[model samples]
Target: MKVTLPDGTELQLEEGATGGDAALAIGEGLARAALAVSVNGELRDLARPLPDGAQLSIITGKSPEALELIRHDTAHVLAAAVMELWPGVKISIGPAIENGFYYDFDFPEDAEVSDADFERIETKMREHVKAKESFTRQDISVQEAIEKFKTENQDYKVELIEDLITNEGAETVSLYTNGPFTDLCRGPHATDTGKIKAFKLTSIAGAYWRGDAKRQMLTRIYGTAFLSKEDLAEHLHMIEEAKKRDHRRLGKQLDLFHFSEISPGSPFWHPNGMKIWNSLHELWTEQNARRGYNRVKTPILLDVDLWKISGHWDKYRDNMYFTDIEDRPMGIKPMNCPAHIQIYKSERRSYRDLPIRYSEDGLVHRHEPSGTLHGLMRVRHITQDDAHIFCTEEQIQDEVIQCLRFGFYIYEIFGFEPKLELSTRPEQRVGDDATWDRAEAALENALQAEGLEYELNPGDGAFYGPKIDLHMKDSLGRSWQLGTVQLDFSMPERFELAYTGDDNDEHRPVMIHRALFGSFERFIGILIEHYGGEFPLWLAPVQAKIIPVSDLFNDYADQVAQTLVDAGLRPDVDARTESVGKKIREAELSKAPVMLVVGAEERDAGTVSVRRRHNAGDDDAKLTIGELVDVLSAEVAERRRPDAG
Candidate 1:
């Protein structure tokens, strides 16, 4: 049979030859380095038979797809090592995630494994790699696979095999063996365990089976792998830096917010935290008002019929909270669009009134799993910077570009260079073909008009719309999906929303739902980590901390704080009866952008000594009250960061 390589090289091979045979036929060096084969653009195990007249490319350990395979293969090694160390440890599924892999297990009731066990497991994994174990793959009948796992008392494997057969109608399943270990997997792993050169087990946690709360909890072990040691070291360093910047820790240390057993996944903002919220809120409202956006407020609980008509009941009901209020089916809004639609339908509108922009800092609730909740990052309660633009079909492209630029402007202000994604129509979306086509095309065109590069995310659009997702990269180079500008044709049509056209005909308005700061809470979390809690003057909760040298200077500090307040600056007086140095230390720990030290000398001169938090080796500059206000207010008005302070 004949095969074509990625480089257009043709080779002849025997009928029963595998990818291994084809690589050898091409060249010895290629054959030696090949981890697997990409046949017709799909990865396949090297031991699998190659198809005739197919396109094949060799995959090495250094290839882009290598990380997933390496981590997955490392997971198998982990399981083997664990079972060897302690018998009767039933292993569940282990798969690669964004940057690593995790395996869940049902440990014996009397025994437990924790972080202490990671080193022992890693040592055994290295031994397996040192042995250069070559993976052997084989296919077994579905019933036989079930029986095999049943005999081993691995109930999770048995349940999975049964699901594969019953739900997917699969007749056979593949099993891969490396040394003395085997797993039921559809794999295109590295040819030998040695290919995974650098790896580490990072953490352990508890997870329910199949992510179902009703199911039994299992232990989950997470680990990451890389082809080279240098990459692994860099990754480890990032992890350490991320830990230091964790918002949950900083939130408490800086006295920003707190969570309670009284309300899980809901943050109770301290006065300090509310300061940060107010800062972002004021900025958002001022800028939006300048853009001709009108503010509106809607009820938090709406009748269920509104949700049903908006397709939320069908699509997002599981993530929603429903209740019966006064014998009427009511739901706490998971999103503001449906309620905004109600506002749009309140009265008749004219084509001249088209392009109506509605903005709100609205509170919403979603039933996020408790396990998935992480401080403000993934909260059940959210205050979203939500806006909906109702415009004519002719104005679709302009509105999209406007919202896209708005989101980018916010990111740019926050010092983030954003990555964009244009998500197209999904398979199960509402609306007609023409509408989807126009929505998708307008989004793509808007992105292109700005000379921005974006990824086409297929089949990931919202059910009622296609959208462009804006992702911001943080200080650690991790990308987060923060804001979206979605174009929808279904909502107006569903609710029969209309305006009198120029021709005097009732026509539906095009809806553009956008959220620049997706959730104020989540954005705060991102900002906390992005700026490493040393927020800029405009966003920092405590813009300035006024420290007095002794109780004698306390009255002067109070006067200074009041002057700052009257000047529209947020300043707090440290009135505690403590030493000046101790007060300065606490002020620094608070991460206030500036510290104003008031002593006898400053009190006599009617001035304050200014010290910037992020500046080093700079002596405190003595400035009169008027002089300080001129300098600080300019920096705060310009939203200058700490370095500028």
Candidate 2:
């Protein structure tokens, strides 16, 4: 049989030939470098038999999919090492994740494992790699696979095979073996353990099996792999930088917020954190007004019937919080769109009011899993900078362009350049194919009209519509999805929303759901890390720290703080009766954007010496009270970053 290569060249091979055989047919060098083969765009193990007349592309170290395969192969090496080090350890599933891979294991009660064992595990992994153990794949009957694991006391593998057969109606399962370790996996791994050139076991944590809270907790080991040691070193350096800039640590150091057992995923915002929230809130309000949006608020809880009509009951009910109110089921709103739709339907609107824009800084609650919650990044309680636009189909392009520009404008203020992604309709959605096609086309046209380049993210849209998602990388080079503009034709139809057209007939108004800042909680977390707790003047909780040289100048510092307050600047007087030098050190540690040092000389001169944190060029410029306030207010008004210059 003959198979087509990526370059459209055909290669003849034996009937039982595998991807390995095809690569060797192409060239010896390619066969040696081949990690796997992409059979008809799907990755297949090199040892797997190649299909006749299939298009095959060699997956080498340079391929985008290489890292995932490397990490996954490394995970097998890790499991093999751990089981060797500690006998009787039961292994669960292991898969490659973003940035790395992790394997969950049910450690024996007598065994204690931690990151301290990483060195030994890595040593054993290297030995396996040095052995050049080729990954051998075998297909076995489901019952035989179950029996194999059951006899080995690997209950997890037994359970998995049973699920595949009972739930998925599977009759066969695949297993991969390297050296003496075997795992039940549907895999497309590297040819051998030797392919994992550089790897490190990064961390260890506890995770409930399959993310179910009721299940037994398993020990999870995370590690990353790269083709070269240089790439691994760079990634390790970034990981170290990320640790120093972790928002949770900064939040505590800066007195921003804290999580409590009383409310698992809810944040108890400190006064300092509230300052950041208010700053973003103020901007959200001002921008909405400039864009002709009417700000509104809605109830947090609504009847589940509303969700059923919105199709979220069927699609998103698993992630929602539900309660009983007056014997009727109520769902805490996970999103504001359904509630906003009700407001749109309340009044009879006209084509003149077609582009009715409603903006809400609304609080929403979701039933997030306990393990998935991160300090502020992932929370059960959230405040969304959400807005919905009701407009005619003809107005879609302009309205969408406005939204795109609005998102860019907001992100640019924080020194972020967001990349756009056009996400199309999902398989499980509420609308007809024709409506979804129109919605997707409208979004794509808007993006083209704006002259913006975007990546096509297929089947990742909301259940109601297709959307344009904005993802931005932060200072640490980590990308995050923050803004979205979704176009929906289904919601209006489902809710029976209408506006009278010029023809004196009612027509369904298209709904455009948009948000520049996805959620206050998550955005603040990103900002905390982005700025490294050294916020700009406008967002800084304590914009200026007023330090008096001694108790003699305390009164002057108080007066200065008051003047700053009257000028709409946040200032705090550091009057601890400490030395001026000590006070300055503490102020710097606090990350105050500006420090106003008041001494006898400045007091006599009726001015304050200005000291900018993190700025080495310090002449300690003296300015009068009036001059100081003007400069600070100007910077705050402009929302200038300390490093913008």
For residues 45-139, write the lDDT of model 1, one tens digit per residue: 88899889999888887678888988989888888888888799898999999899998989999877899989989998899989989888989
Q: Top TM-score: which candidate number?
A: 1
Candidate 2: what lDDT? Answer: 0.92
Summarize candidate 2's per-residue lDDT along 264-341 as a digit string, tens digits.
999999999999999998899888999899998999999999999988898889989999988999999999999898
Model 2 reaches what TM-score against the true structure?
0.89
* C-alpha positional error of residue 484 in candidate 2 after TM-score superposition, expressed in Å: 1.9
Model 2 residue runs over 4 Å out of place are: 12-18, 24-29, 47-49, 106-109, 138-175, 180-185, 207-218, 299-334, 338-347, 369-372, 427-434, 616-618
lDDT of 1: 0.89
Each model's lDDT: 0.89, 0.92
RMSD of 1: 2.9
Q: Which stretches of candidate 1 lie over 4 Å from their true place?
A: 7-17, 21-32, 106-110, 140-173, 207-218, 313-330, 369-371, 614-616, 642-645
